[model samples]
Target: MGLWFLNRPRPIKRTISVILDFLAIPFSLWLAFSLRLGEFYIPPNQQLWIFVLAPVLAIPIFIKSGLYRAIIRYIGMDAIWTIARAVFLYSLIFSVIVLTFNDLAGLVPRTVYAIQAIILMLFVGGSRMIARWLIVKSDHHLWKEVNAVRYIPPVLIYGAGRAGTQAAALMKLSNQMRPVAFIDDNVTLWRQQINGMTVYGVDQLAKLIERFKVRDILLAMPSAGRRRRSEILKLLEHYPVHVRTLPDLMDIAEGRLEVSDIQEVDIADLLGREPVAPINNLLSKNITDKAVMVTGAGGSIGSELCRQIIHLSPSCLVLYEASEINLYQIERELASLALDIPVYSMLGTVLNQQRVEMVCRRFGVNTIYHAAAYKHVPIVERNTNEGIRNNVFGTLHCAQAAIDAEVETFVLISTDKAVRPTNTMGATKRFAELVLQAFAESKTLYNKTRFTMVRFGNVLGSSGSVVPLFRDQIAKGGPVTVTDPEIIRYFMTIPEAAALVIQAGAMGKGGDVFVLDMGEPVKIVDLARRMIHLSGFTIRDNDNPNGDIEIDYTGLRPGEKLYEELLIGDNVSATEHEKIMRAEECVIEWPALVKIIRELELANKHDDCQKARAILLDTIDGFIPQCELSDWLGNDN
Candidate 1:
């Protein structure tokens, strides 16, 4: 019973540490009397009867300081400060009692106050420190070992601040990884140690790597912004060691530190986020107390849009999605949010013109955001016809319905892929942009019915992006695949992408093709290695034999490129939002665009994959097919 009670961490027992301090109140009183006088003296009025009610006075003081709730092991300087403040005030009240009781008995000496206060504080404070010391001593043996049989690996963390220390403690608990050292950028911290791990300078990475044979370096610099991280990544680039980084401070797991939540750094960090200063009034102006509709609401980009829009107090938000499960997932989230505004989950495809028109008319949707498209490169490479139908026709269906419903603003979530492309997916999206560009070109275009497009690069962690692929491969315990390790692409967070889209949609004056200012591109190989390292693994290559993960290059896929360009034409002019730009270029008239779209639609309907590929190349500028045999694909079909 005694062993179990000692081992257990309980709320009542945690309070017991504080209660022990109150038990010393008698000594505190005795010392107070002794200090005011030259020696211990008990007045006739201050007989032992005062000690009987000491617990009553101490309980309020302890409760006021929030001392009872303070766990001894976790107590730090802040708690000590609170204790001092509470004790000083508590002493004043106790002294007042002495004065009041003097009316009943004889007077108490003033020197007694000084001795009592000093003794009381020492007793109360020393008990907590003693408890803390014992707890630390008990856990000392645990701080020395780690799990080798478990899935955990050995790791050395960077930084010794809040983020780093928390990460170290968490890694220890999971027993999946052991933290060997802390590699901080601060020179002063280099010789120091945290949690028994010596801190080293950033420059000593190679030495540390060689000495400990450390497999991975986990960056605990959650406070590091994009620019700083980019600089760090560049410095560490040539080391041939895998690198991983913590998520942005705000995004780190509910502001709690845990090892299982420790994730591999992905490409998002390389494309450091430039904070968005939203045109808030403009964004909330249209949606507030107005009916809003989002097409493709179940998609990664579209779902985020819904999440933000719902918070803006739209009179009613309608989520129009074709996929059943996607709709259910997003709908369940909104339902749980319990917002006052009506949230309707409508099942309907954007490509179904009549279905879209009916929903818009029925819901009285005043605002529309179009985000549906086939985005995968290799998949879209083969299924060219379906890609065009969904990209081009799906967009057309939603746009015309919004027009017929007299919607206020229609924002098309576009991509850098729409830029002059080598792939059919890019060409189809360019054609869709043209579909809006032609509608915007009309002399009859209305200020009320504004249409616009926001173009940016791949979003990190989106359904088809490299981040998830790298993460999954890393988890699978072997080779992490990259298509041409040198392939570079721009990346952004889904929320950042959605924010830009919302801001761009509001900025549009109809038919404007706005491009998001994506920061510098990141190489795929570096991204892979960082992910491997952050996941507590070293990359297997010529330099490291203990590496747990292997990087394999599969060569570029069909219709894919080493890089993608955001600007289709050089005539792009900056917008009000520095990150957004408007592009001016040649456009096929709506008549011609419609003609191409019709043919493309028919090709998809008849399964004429060759004809679909043929029309895509002729219609879109800068498109080149890696494979000429449309018939071979059709046969495989």
Candidate 2:
């Protein structure tokens, strides 16, 4: 019956509420009179009309107060308050009428009105509360019956604050997970009940986990700082529970995401370093109101650069990408952003000197962020000639075009591997940097464009980054591969890297090599372990033979490095932005660098990987091949 009423239409439910209230109002009055007289006293002729008048007056008042409009399944405090106010008004008017007409109404008891009002208030309010419980309970039972085979894992929510309470409420409605309790750092909240779930301290996590068999812990502290979150994650890492988190408070607030929309623990939370707020002046210096062009605009870094640039309100944004699909996706996204600024998406490779120059000239491009290049180390090592042609001559063509178009600023996105360069990709990137440096030096007389290179370590979530690969491996319940136990690399988030790159570019004078201060490098084995553990899995090693996931130590790939460096030498100076620094590195003059680039291009045309390797080794400083040339085409000279 309760389920039938719960599924009824709103009008039918409201009508039922009205009929129930009409019946309860007069019965409450009769009970009040009997209790006041201390007997089962029947009302006299005069007072019989008083009982009939009781409901007539109250019913209209209740209707006006919207009492029947409240849904029994979801009635809250406001609805209860409305009932209270309506009953009080009715009681006041009934008392005034009875006392004023007592002589004519045959002497009604003064205590009767007060007694009946209290009874009526309880009857009206309590029935709705009972109905709400019944409907909700019936609905839950029905849902459970329908999904009897589906297992809903119980979870513990961290942080017994507003977000946690809300998360618990949302979980109650979810079929996938059930929230069992809250774990908070606040000692005062310990053993206290929130939304019927007890809040416990971190020490009780073991008992709670064992008692409830919780396999996941949802982090509900959206407002907590990264350091605090990292500390919490470190504490949780000891337990066998998968950790997920709400997005940052800003993302939740602005994006309309709920606290219960849990996601995998952010990779940045492991870094624990709070990003320094970007300097607005430096961010907008080369971008604001300028015609900016981003080569490889559909790539990870290039696309992020575009996203940030649109907010700064550029006059127009030019996306020059080699891939048709990438260009289409980014263009569609920018169009959705709905900024008044014009966005021009051109499908063209940076390798075409004339095409790049024409785009720059037509767009009156003031700033060019050159980000197009092959970056995967092993792939570039195998495709040696193509890698050189793209990373080396691609940069050359863009730089030359920037100069020809008289573009104001040009920034090349370089990598940490470019420092010592054991891989073909890294060497080509270094060679590209040298090309820009030479151009910047030669243009000292004309000074048409300022060339800057921003070098940083690996960016999390970028294409070919290990973070996603490890996540996929962990999800697949298998061996997570690491190149070497001792291998370590610096890591930064893509957005932060892009913002710092922009700031660094603004600080560039000419021929500047800016090295971003990537935080301490993390060991590959430790990273793999942390990822596995945080994902609620244990590493399968000699000590833990029954562990969930195995760690496979695949020896280093061709041209892979055990460690990466950001600066070529220790001669580095701090820039205006704290995270960005200027490096004093060797630069080949334009005359010498151009000759080497032409030889590389000729070798590339003939598919001579050996000659190309020789040119790169002879040209780039500290260039060493980690493995013999493994070009798909034979490396015969």
Provide the clashing-pair count of each candidate structure.
Answer: 8, 0
- Could you estimate the TM-score for every candidate? 0.88, 0.85
> Cα-based RMSD of the predictions, in order?
3.6, 4.6
- The whole-model C-alpha lDDT of candidate 2 against the native structure comes to 0.89
Tens-place lDDT per residue, model 1, 1-637, is 3333347677757556656766777667766666666765765644666665555786687787787777666667888887888778777887777667756335566666666777777888887777766766554434443232334456778778888887886676555677888888888787897877898887787888788777777878877776777667666655645567676677564755556666655455555565677878767866888899988899999899999999999999999988999999999998889999898999987788898888888989988989878888778877776777789889988888888778888998888877778877787888888888888776554335788988899888889888878878888986999889689998888988888888888888878888988887889887887667556566888897777889999998867888888997789898787888888767777767778878888888998877888888788887776655363486443
**Model 2 Cα lDDT, one tens digit per residue, 1-637:** 6788888999998888888989988898889888988999887676678778888999999999999888686578899899989999998898887777846444567787788889988999999998888877886797687568777888999999877776776667666678989999999999899978999999999999999999999998989888898899998999999999887676656645554468999988977878999999999999999999999999999999999999998899999999999999999999998889999999998889999999999999999999899999988998898888889889988998998889999999999999989999999999999988888788553368999999999999999998999999999997899989899999899999999999999999999999999988988788788889899999899999999999999999989989899988999999878899999999888787767878888889988888999998998889998998744546422
Pairs that collide in candidate 1 are: 31-115, 32-112, 32-115, 32-116, 36-111, 152-176, 153-176, 243-530
lDDT of prediction 1: 0.77
TM-score, structure 1 vs. true: 0.88
